[model samples]
Target: MNEQPRNPDPEIGDAFYGFVASEPQLTWHDGTPRLYFKAGQEHYEYGPDGSRTKLPTTFHDVVAFRGAAVSGDETLSKLDWFVAHGRLEPNTNPNTGVETKEFIANRLGPDAARMNIEIGTPRRRSQMESPNRRQPARQVVFEPPEQDQPEHEQPTRAM
Candidate 1:
């Protein structure tokens, strides 16, 4: 088996912070659950006089698999703001040979503070589609891993 790094620089890993463009779609891919969504980021600038300006919004397709997909299906929506980190992947259409690009999220979640939201249970499909009585929404909150934070701001352990 051969293993090669797709991107040599870890700093260049795929990262995106933006608004979700649509409700996430959850489905099975190769028997592992997957979640897909589109996210849009609008560029802005502050002028010398403090005036704000907007630039064209950039959009990216984001896909989450496994545990990430499970969590996303519950809490993600078009109305939410999101942040994701993964890798840029390129694909070619088999029939036409046209190339397309996508970002597959290894870590993803809503920006609760930016969205002014309190944590709440995600409305999962399983609960919605089940013939039995619906279960109450389960609230879950996540904190970023220590390694993911800036070195200067990393939390310190008590002696």
Candidate 2:
């Protein structure tokens, strides 16, 4: 039998609206890395007949390296079979794949090259460059290269 250690409640009290996620991409909040997932539950009631349901949105703050991603996939699960994998790199670019464009939390050091998080992702302090850079159209104002015209002699006959 395995026993888990009892953790104390936060000084500010517990949260009851959003769940603390542990689904990867854990991050830090104000320089502090929160390793634990603070979960909460809410009640949901069904239509006329009889049904009670609960819909939860867990909010977690795990610590990982934070940086500007070159690109990566969104919705990592959608990108491939997770197989309950513990390591999370999201295999794809946030700008191109299954990851959301919000923020990517990856491990420090380079075994890899880049990382990206799609929009709607989670983060306490995240930053990203605009994927779509508006290129200014090249305008060619043709001035004929300012060719020196041949010197024209005035007509000798001054009639």
Best by TM-score: 1
Q: Write the per-residue lDDT of candidate 2 for residues 1-159, one digit (tens) a residue.
A: 988669967334221222223333434678644322222234576867786666653332322333411111122211121111122233344586764222223422111112244435432112444557686899978765777776996667866
Top model by lDDT, which number? 1
C-alpha lDDT score of every prediction, in listed order: 0.79, 0.33
Give stretches of model 2 more than 4 Å off: 1-24, 29-63, 66-140, 152-159
Clashes of each: 1, 28
TM-score of candidate 1 versus the correct structure, residues matched by position:
0.61
User: TM-score per candidate, in order?
Assistant: 0.61, 0.18
RMSD of 1: 15.7
Cα lDDT, model 2, residue 150: 65
Q: Please, what are the lDDT tens digits per residue for candidate 1 over residues 1-159?
A: 899989786555778788889789999978998999888888999899999999899887788999888887777788578778888899676899988887888788877668654456464343355457787899999997766546576578999
- Kindly give the stretch of ten consecutive residues in candidate 1 with the minimal lDDT sum: 121-130
Question: How far is each candidate from the true structure, as Cα RMSD in Å?
Answer: 15.7, 21.1
